[model samples]
Target: MWAARLAAPCLLLAAATAPLDARAAEESEAQPPAAEAPAWSGSLAAYLNLPRGNEAYVTGIAIANRGALHLEARSNYEGMDAYSFFVGYNLGVGEAVRLDFTPILGFVTGSTHSVVGGFEATLTGRYADAYIEFEYVPDAQPSGYAYAWSELAFRPVDWFRIGLAAQRTRVHDNGRNLQRGVFAQVKGKHVSGAVYWFNPASHEQVTVISVAISF
Candidate 1:
């Protein structure tokens, strides 16, 4: 009798909490589905980003290669002085289709900062001399939730190329915006340079210039 009396109030408490849990679950289910990834042709490439802020000036290097398997790793300086590690994998390239997986770890300079993770995915196709890609940013989070980015690139000349891309990012739970950018790259036997322009979140225009050497 004593044990039964002790369990009765606990059961009532659980019954009271159950509806709150069910309501939260329903809300999550009502959200939209994840976006579909873009399409592209498979190629191996290396990228280096030289940023002017954060570390006063920091360089980010990335290498992405394709075979039967693929691996990638990159690091960047965020905002003022924070750094993060992003690692990912690509699969099915040797076959007719491809799949990708990415996991990230982040660190900040201050004690109040929290580490977060984000990832992206893309599918690619080839048509004539042009390649197209559709990409989805799973969750941009501390980097900002730039949800989707799609690109089309064409090689008119062997060492010259042009690309057009569009991106959509969610700034807050109920707010989002779009960005469009154009890029051109010219490669010579030992030197290369690129120019790109885009509109940022604050509705300001920004441009990037990059010069690099080929090994």
Candidate 2:
């Protein structure tokens, strides 16, 4: 009788574990664990500022992003010796014609100190894209000031772009408040280089060389 009793308990224990293992496998298949979050993509760009009758300088900018979150920094972008940091959210809209905009808020430091507000927007079509950016500085000397930069680009091939560029700034003063020019860019897998010639007229010509890397 003791032998049969021991065998009975062992059989019952095996029966219990068999259902437990089956239930665990079923639950695991029904609800899977979540996946890891997506990674951020970003870029850094440098511009070599060369203008007629002015000292040469370099402008640096960096951006880090994850999804809709945007972060950016600039040195010597707003003015000479100036630095700024910005936070913005990327908003995208449209299908046939698309628009992407980032309304950025930042603080200026180093040269001209102030609170800055602006937006970077791009309108895209079949073969061309139009981009515009503006920043307002309420604490500028004398009064509030606004600066703008714009580009209209046409792409005949995937890796090359020809564009018309315009800007209003005090960053480089060669006796002109507004500068307009032509630019061409050649892009590789992760790097791009562009040359801009502003005020193409011989009198107050300005040239800018841009090199950028994306990750």
User: Which residue runs does candidate 1 get wrong by more than 4 Å?
Assistant: 1-59, 64-78, 94-150, 167-178, 188-192, 200-203, 211-215
Candidate 2, number of clashes:
0
**lDDT digits (tens) for residues 96-208 of candidate 1:** 33444443333333311444444444443332122232223323334433234455567677687688765453321223265567778888876777665545444344445
Clashing pairs in 2: none
* Native-referenced Cα lDDT, model 1: 0.46
My TM-score estimates for the predictions, one after another, are 0.43, 0.84
Q: Give the number of the best model, judged by lDDT.
A: 2
78 in model 1: Cα distance from truth in Å?
4.5
lDDT of 2 by residue, 96-202 (tens): 79999999999999988999999999998878889998999898766778888899999888788898999888887776779999999999999999999999976
Score each candidate by Cα lDDT.
0.46, 0.91
